[model samples]
Target: MLLNHNQSSLSFHSELYSFVPEDHILRRVHDLVDFSFINDLVKESYCVYYGRPANEPELLFRLLFLQFLYNLSDERVIEDSQYNLAYKWFLGLNPEDSLPDSSQLSRFRVHRLGANRVEKVLEHIVKQCVEKGLIQSKALIIDSTHTLANAAKGKPLDVLKKAANRLLKGVKKQYSSLYKKLPMFPKLEGADEEKAKQLLQYLVELRNLLEDKLPDAEGSLLEKINTVKQIIEDERLLTNKGIASAVDPDARFGRKSNSRTFYGFKNHIAMTEEEIITAIHVTPGNEDDGKQLQTLVNKTREQQITIDEVFADTAYSRKENLTFLQTDEIKASIPLNPAVYGTREDDKFQYDKENDEVICPAGHTSIRKAKTGRTGTGTNPCLTFYFDTNICKQCPFKDGCYNNTKEKTYSISIKSEEHIHQMAYLDSDEYLQRKGLRSNIEHKNAELKNAHRMTRAKYRGQFGMRIQAFLTAFVVNVKRMIKLEMAHSE
Candidate 1:
């Protein structure tokens, strides 16, 4: 239950905030930003007439703001807020007011402002900047950064054993009777593959037993059961990149470059040239960066920011993305991905955009076309056009052109008119100038990792990573808003 009042009641020691400095960052943040919306944002998570009156959502949210702002742990943030006058003032607490336990921070993050609501935290702050006329840039720079998983990557057998142990541990802690009724883990002596299979079968039986005994299990117990189910269902657990760690099943192996790799997740972000982030989308490490462009753009537009230009690297230069930008009339400063637009090596084959077909030098048009190869896997997919082999067989120029095979085909790397136009724009002075704007996002990524502890996952799983990401973004945006407002005054 939420209280229908603010928590900033005056106290006998209220004057302690005077020494917190007139221009303290927290004081400026308190004065400039309105955090009252948090109460409404998380209102649905609480019961109106059940249980004890809950801690004020706004106050709890302020603790999260302080946590990400200073990169402090939940315990540290709560401990500091207990006595720090500025923190107390920023949280709308009178001096000497008691703080909710540090554990409440995790509860609030998971139950109150969950993944569905965390995005709103970033969105709300961005809308505030827009409302204040501080985010005036028409260009949105986009990029992605990596965060290492909290759990270490493990082999399939090790992962299976770890998951089994955790489920048993949770059941033992929460339901000791159920623990005895559950199947005991068996010892096996065999090859790793055989051992993994045995462990997997054991987990399958254990899950079945739990389902029968606890039909309505929820909370951490439910999560453990679900994790076991995922592990059991993954057919390629031994052969492919599936479930590296039972602790973090959602994280995957992603390549940072041709030779470098990391085990974790990705934070796809869109920001204004003003250096304020407008949108953030977190995905598994191996997820494609280009696919998130549309989502980021839509989220940024949702904040009422007029976006006329977008800046990104070659990773975002897919033909589909370019077409979307063309349809929306948004200027794209992204460089062409060489895999999408390779050199026109063979002048004999010309592409016809309007017909969406390629013409051979002999004036014969392709009959059917098919795309080959997986996208976003550091591979070049080709749009191959098949021709009537009879036509090629009878052509006078068939000597060296058509190999005497069962079929005749000509292939061109995916070449769209939007890509052609973008390629042309890539050489212009304006494109080069606007391209430099994307570098600031790299610095923003650095700040998130270096200054805000976003370099590694603080908690396990994607939801935890997302919670960390949005809260971190929220803190940086508020700081950026302060700087922008101050500059406008100067």
Candidate 2:
């Protein structure tokens, strides 16, 4: 067969595709990140898996890096790989090979990027940043943001019960239809019947009560009660579906915004002066930020890095936390709550250094109560002071001193001697020099939120959200490393 070819359509090319050099900044970043170190840390024997043996492992790894570096969604990443030459070069993709599907990317994220893997990758990035002189390991700013989970806005118990009853009625109709088709169908009676009836009845009652109580319930009480009722109804709904979970529960709610209570987790991050993410934590949504700080700090310590100072907001300013930081040889620079510092009532209780006693406003010195106490890890020694009941009761400022209580309260408190010492150290010019560097992490936070789109998490569940956060931090560190390298080249 003879065919006439159009010269314009059949034009010959010198090469399969013209190659462009990788960006200098991206190349420098690749050198600084140390992919092997990250692989060793994040890629576990059970966690790592390959679908097609021909697929390059490095390419997959780089895909995760891109997630944070560019803050691209899974679909966007696929589109970029197909259309954008820069993204193609970054992922080390050849000109002929087609980009991976979005679903494959999603599966890879879920099956391979578990909590431990994400943490390990983050630690490696932080270590690299420290080695490159990009991150200051000694000083750190720790903060947590609430990541909303993928759960629905739960309805009140009464409303949910009504809905469940409606569902049950539909299920019964289907069951009856099936029973008619099969003459020998098992009877849907006994415990199952009683359970169904009881659940339906309770739901109806709950719905009625909620409608009545909603108008009268004051402040947050109504919302709280409504949430509680919704949780109960949800549990019942799940039970009807013959489902149970030892881990995932309806009680789990997002911490990001209480208004958007969802089933997921919280992400806590510790950032260094060089904008490297030193540590990250993914916990249940209901977990308190105050409880996670010490654990995160401990984890950072385990990396063989000494933290000199820990900066946080008022949530971490409790006496227990202050004492913990002092004992750990780490300085905690948390601001006092306005109520605690602004009020002059506490000024009366002055510390008497000579006697280790607390002097009340009435010129009465209180003696020490306990010398030691036990914390989460071990015993902690502390000095406590208390005022005499007789003196406190007859004082003219007794109401201000004792909250108008007849008990004439005796309080036991741990005086942070090390905290006072640290405070003195912080007040020095040299310490102030280091403390001034803490503001850098704020800019880093802003970059992650605004530039990297970390202001809101893209994934649902604690594990997925954490992976996203880790990737964001990893990308931030890489960018910092790239900038540092460029500065050095200059």
Candidate 3:
């Protein structure tokens, strides 16, 4: 049933203050947060004199915020608003007020506040937290968790079949002559695997024939052809039954670890030890966590928060990342990948930077030393040190040190100052003490998944996931701020 959103016809009489508890969570949050700033944050999103009569901007935002705060679905949020007294009071509505349409929230996110604008909402709220002293940006904990896409592990052939049929209708509309020449769109729904494969190949043939006529086709049309190309033409498409989503092509197969895998995106987050989220960045499931460390820290900095220390798991360790953190004076609590180094005994070798020589395992030193793989810009370059083969070949423990190969010599080479700092940090008590704080982000990630609906993504594609992620961070941060406010009030 369609909801009647006509505000003029609704009754306005209600004693909501008497109905709600003095210390209600939502009520306290409502009192603590000055949502009036939201008007300015979203002012440009609204047109002064266009479109039909719309719901109030504050009303839309409050209801949308409630979704992640309570982990309610679109239909569930609207339904709860009608019966839930707290929700009614939060929205400033009387008991008999007409609820906004459920679908309207979806439309509002896509049209009114897109991914970019919603990001602004999260940042603005986080800035408020910073100003109120609820969260400090001196140290940040970073982590990534997988959110399953709104798609299934459907067979690649079945995925291609849908894309092909959608393209068939388009070709019939745009180029009738070519459409007639192509084979008729085959029916493959619920068909046997062999039958589906045959039909899929036929569609591929038709698409190839059309490529000569219109080489620049895109959108759903181009997606349809690529769907087939990814399945047949690509060698590594899905040999192990790996398949990308047909609806949300941006989502890829991601793994929790070597043992577990899920098809969706990774939500990389930065938070303080107080468990308050500062920023969020979502990437395809298979994206490397280390690559996004700087991006996440930069996001927090954009809100005027300074990140002096970073805590993350081993996945976020890279030579470049360690160099970046050390150079910026931000202490990194990330453990370097042992694979980045040589054998256990080889770690005993020390560097003498002054003479540009490496002391070998048997007290022998390399005569020739060369710098390899310099990182960062000039004036502050971090150079990697490599020793010559002549000194390494004559070592008593050469078999154990060099692993009997020319490549192993370079692989085991000492990475100047950056590696030294990382090793010293690993041996320090501060790394052990601060390393526990990294788990704070894991708890935060769990809250997003277990309490919030981040276990499975709601909206599709990168833009859609971005909208959901920013809103999730926004809702979580608000909750954290209120909790901190209550604690401080006590």
Candidate 4:
């Protein structure tokens, strides 16, 4: 049950908090933010009239806030708060009052706030910033950073074996009698591929057995069953781009650059010029950065924050995105990707925007074009323009440009009038200045990883990653708001 929100009476020990200076960061944060809303946000998740008196949701939330603010683990945060006077004062606990057990932090995080409500934590914080007039700029910057998965990448066979063993163990542990009725682990005496098929078949049988016997299994057993189902249904299990770990099935392989890759999740973020984060979109590592632009924009707009301009890298320069900004009448300072505009050696080919065709160096225009390749894959989808080889065969430029190829084609990965207009805007002084503003978000990303320990996930699975990301964003935003407030006062 959620306890009452009555203020605790001051005790003799409470006076000891006087030693914590009024100018302390936590003190400033406590004054800046009215954390009482936390209680309301988590009220429904708690039992109102049943169970023993539970810790106040606000208090538990404060502990979590302190935990992320200091970059401490669950145990360490509770332990440190017990002795740290400033922490005690920030938590609004009497000096002698004992803290709730560290484990409560996880229970509260997983059950109370959870994935559904965690996002509200960030949204509420951003709302507070807007209310205070801390976020004044109409321009928002968008970017994404990677968080390494807690689980290591494993081979397909190893992943299958591990998942099966986990399911079997969970069944035995939870329902011993049911375990005995289930089929034993399948014997393997063949090549890796053959053994994998046998193990997969056994897992399917095992799932059917459990579903029949324990039709209402919940918690870890249900989770394990679901995990096994995922492993079974994944057709790309044997491929490199497939599930790499049963422990973190949500994570996928994503590239940091052409030479560097990371296996984990991405924290796609949108921030104001004030450096306060307005929205966060978490996805598997392999998710496209460009796809999240609309999500981030809509999320920011949800807060009633007017977004007249967006600053981002070339990844956000897709033709669709340019059109999106244009329709909304929002200014976009994103750099154009050469792939979208189609580059050439010494400008041998030029796009004729009016006719929607490419002009060869010899002034030969393309006849027809076809869009090829699947979008949202790692590869860039292109519009391939087929030129008549009949004209190329008799042209002087045929030797180097056309040769004797069956099809004389010029391909541009992306094309639109929006892109053409964007290309022209890219050279303007306004675009150049705003382009540099996007780099400021890079520092914020670094601070999140280096200072808050968001470089690697602290918990397993996508849910855990979302919890980590939003909470960290909350801490960072709170700190930034405090700084902004301080500056305003001076």
Q: Which candidate gets the maximum TM-score versus the true structure? A: 4
What residue pairs are clashing in model 4?
Answer: none
Span of ten consecutive residues with least summed lDDT in model 4: 373-382
lDDT of 1 by residue, 299-322 (tens): 999889999999999888877888
**Better TM-score candidate (3, 4):** 4
lDDT of 1 at 174: 91
In model 1, the worst 10-residue window by lDDT is 338-347
Clashes per model (N, Cα, C within 3 A): 0, 1, 0, 0
The all-Cα superposition gives candidate 2 an RMSD in Å to the true structure of: 11.4
Please give the CA lDDT of all the candidate structures. 0.89, 0.58, 0.75, 0.89
Please provide, for model 2 over 52-152, each residue's C-alpha lDDT reduced to its tens digit, 9 standing for 90 to 100: 33233355667767766777778887777776655655665555557767776665566565666767777777676666666545877887765544443
Query: RMSD per prediction, one decimal?
Result: 5.7, 11.4, 6.3, 3.6
User: Which has the higher TM-score value, candidate number 2 or candidate number 3?
Assistant: 3
Q: Give the TM-score of candidate 4.
A: 0.90
- Number of clashing pairs, model 2? 1
Candidate 4 Cα misplacement greater than 4 A, ranges: 346-409, 412-414
The TM-score-based order of candidates, best leading, equals 4, 1, 3, 2
lDDT of 1 at 294: 94
